[model samples]
Target: MLIPPRVPNRREDGLLHFDLLPPLSLYVHIPWCVKKCPYCDFYSHAISSAVPEERYLTALEQDLEASLPLIKGRQVSTVFIGGGTPSLLSGDAINKLLVILRNKLLLTPDVEITLEANPGTFDDDKIKAYREAGVNRLSIGIQSFNQKHLDILGRIHDVNQAKRAVEIAMTHFDNVNLDLMYALPHQTKDDLDADLTMAISYDPAHLSLYQLTIEQNTYFAFNPPDLPDEDTVADMQDMIEMMTATAGYEHYEVSAYAKPGRACRHNINYWLFGDYLGIGSGAHSKITVDGKVIRQTRFEQPPTYMLEAGKGRAVDEEFTLSHEDLGFEFMLNALRLTKGFYPEMFEERTALPLDSIRPYLKQAEKRGLLYRDPTIIRPTEKGMLFLNDLQQIFLPDE
Candidate 1:
């Protein structure tokens, strides 16, 4: 049971200085889904009648209470309740959770609260209830509108249902994001185009278009489906970006698009290396206290998390970041943005000198994996394709 030690505080220029403390966000994981998608790799379990929603909510509140000491006085500006279909919970249950968050955390009036909703689970009443519970944003999982693609992806909703879900979401929430997947097995360009057009027709404020990937432990992994060729996948990506841009959406991140001023702030916080607290089963968090970055995780199993509620012993482990590790992490996330971070942000966030990362920047620039202007460090087209290689350049020497 060894734990990583926290870094010692140091002084700079006769003034006490610690690592930069970024703004905090909160992530709540809902681990239950109606049915697992074959290509999914997230930590979600199939739903049963024995979900124990009331008890789970109680455990979540207690979990927040125990973590209060660490997050005291920090104002939470964003909260994303993501999952195996967080919309499965009744509106009352959702409201109860929000009530607990408001009571325990410093929730700003304009905080962006996003709940992940599966199309099949959302109804008009549930949508209105969720809106009433203070959820301002909805990210609906509408993977594809093609019936064949839907079946292949194991989505419960049909094309019409998916369209209806978006209409319902827009009616209830001002900001709505549609999640779509492309490059499925035997999927044609026409199929991809139709899905994108259907998604756009709904006039969602944001879009998250992801490429389907086969992951380990999924049914697809054991008997992998014949996926689209690499060239075809690339074509799909190109077409999606073109269509989305033509429709006036900004391709902010690789997979995300947004209307003006509608980018997901919580995800931006993550890409910018801000602090966040992760609550619920199998959640992970990184927080900054007095300049030390503290990383922690909660129990992964539902029963274990419930059993350890209020004891503060639900955490599997806690550790602090090393200086070198922090730099790599900061850049790893920051570089993902098409518009890379400002030069001064590195120093402000990592408490490290600008010169510390010069060598990596020079190497990456030479390889055309990154673009460096006088003020910003952004990834080039080549860099985005080989992101892992670009990130490896920042890793600490062994």
Candidate 2:
């Protein structure tokens, strides 16, 4: 690790000081997919021809080189390769990319490296190659086992393919995460129950069950499908909680469940407001320098991002976090966890006094939206149900 020069917190000194910095992670994005789903809003482009795998890898290398200055010496605790379907890249491509990371970055010895894969894009050999390339975890996107729901969501894989993907991943990796979505158009409690049952049957190490929502630019938003009523959706949520609990899974986050010690460390770092450096097209990064926090983003389009990255200037936008921004941002993420955060972490992460947010904390507790004591600050049952309202209590006044 390349340790940066540290200075004292004294204002008189020229340099800034952070007594201790948060853990760091890395996120690599692959922006090409076989097809873009209508309801998807992430910046992923559909490839009509072969993927530009080699060019994209080179661009990622350049982006990482440019970013090393900001994170000199800090060991990356985790690396998550997410995307348009990172599985689309050939196994050799993945190997080369991981080699680049190993050569350039000071990664922790037991770094939790995860790669996101789609059923339609991988085979036994490909999955094996990823495991050989130092990827210790695999997160497979299996939206639904029901053929109708799979088609409705524009997923390329069928029921069999989804099962095969999981089987193959289980063979190659011990740590796996299966993603599923509930509250689809015209879905019912029974539909969700079936999906949950199928997912639980796999006995995956981690489960990320999300509720589908239409975003402004998504196809579902424009041509809205008939969705279940709020009450019906509520029942589905309850059923999910009950079933997963019965299956011996712990609901640690809003939409995540895991076996003992199997929670995604990468995601946990995010919810804890830890720093991460994102590389690749359309990636975003948050880093803390000295005592100030900075946010950055690369260009959204693949072509544009690749072009800029070759010049060692992939970052398109950058900004520093303000005091109010820090307070709101911290709560926005940390509050998502059912376990909440430690009070001292508020000061450690945001570099602000804990007393700063005490009034807002009191307000949330008064409204029965939060419960805080010396040991920890967590959400109550009501707070979890109305999480948006609870998080809003800490928002900076406009």
Candidate 3:
């Protein structure tokens, strides 16, 4: 009930603009890592030697400059620097990027700046320096606390390294999130319990507990590991929910849990279908103009992205959402939340009357897959379990 006031209008004509609905968030991608994990499918490459820190920074700045027209005068409330290993960048590099953002964008003073760090690539000094450079949050990738499981997942960091990384992050950041994976190949219930215990011992403010899936184009897909069966994965999820709840963390999203007043604002922006600008290699963005929604993606490969920077070739794809597609997209993100969205937001964002979604809502309610009050539309327990089925209801009829 404590929603922030809408973003202010800065236009000279005094006309209301949909782009000013809320302050937009920003995502910057760092595409290099020490090594690629077998089950990972994100756009990233392994660094064989030294990182081209300066060259990459320049390219990123150029990319940001090119994106300025799409998001001019919008205040950025959150910035998430995610990638293969954002921690691999030196504090100076991070600072330089922040400076560029400050110069090019209207970044709020209290912007929630987050960096996704790989344990093996970060040290105490680097962690502290990152804080000094304006990173207010750290999301450390600690897939497992068991050394054997770490090896099986082909992670570069060991159990001890993950522990140290969390410890170091705690010293520098008040807002620290730990990323853990469950349902791994050959993982036992005891292994998952131990991993959760270790993570809880660190007392992180946020947690992203993800279930491992053998994604295509990864080594695991070619020579799959003997992962636990479906029932075990379900049990693992239940155990995680129970333990985290006991520790006073709220399951705000499907995979995210946070202590009181600690949920990630940036990701919340994402799930709410708020506007955001994405910069750097393989980044995607969604924006609204004149009540029409547009989706876009930047160049995928690093070399190609750098070459296209400032040349208008950096943007690889763009699409304007149809009325029905916009409605479906809005529901796709808003329904992912356990609480769902206010009934008014559907019409506000999608430019479709509430009646347009009424039939789908009625069907879902009849099926016991949705909970609808006069004010909000939310998924039921059954719907959460079979979310795909619930989402399909919103698809436009052919």
TM-scores, each model vs. reference: 0.94, 0.96, 0.93
lDDT of each: 0.86, 0.90, 0.85
Candidate 3 residue lDDT tens string, 308-341: 8757567889887765576677888888888888
Ranking by TM-score: 2, 1, 3
After superposition, the stretches of candidate 3 with alpha carbons farther than 4 Å from their true spots are 1-20
TM-score result, candidate 2: 0.96
10 residues in a row with least lDDT, candidate 3: 1-10
Shift of residue 41 alpha carbon in model 1, Å = 1.4
| lDDT comparing candidate 3 with the true structure | 0.85
Candidate ordering by lDDT (highest first):
2, 1, 3
Worst window of 10 by summed lDDT in candidate 2? 1-10
Which residue pairs in candidate 2 collide? Answer: 1-73, 2-73
Tell me which of candidates 2 and 3 scores higher on lDDT. Answer: 2
RMSD of each: 3.8, 4.7, 5.2
What tens digits encode model 2's per-residue C-alpha lDDT throughout 275-314? Answer: 9999999999999996688999999999999999999999
Clashes of each: 0, 2, 0
Candidate 1 vs candidate 3: the lDDT winner is 1
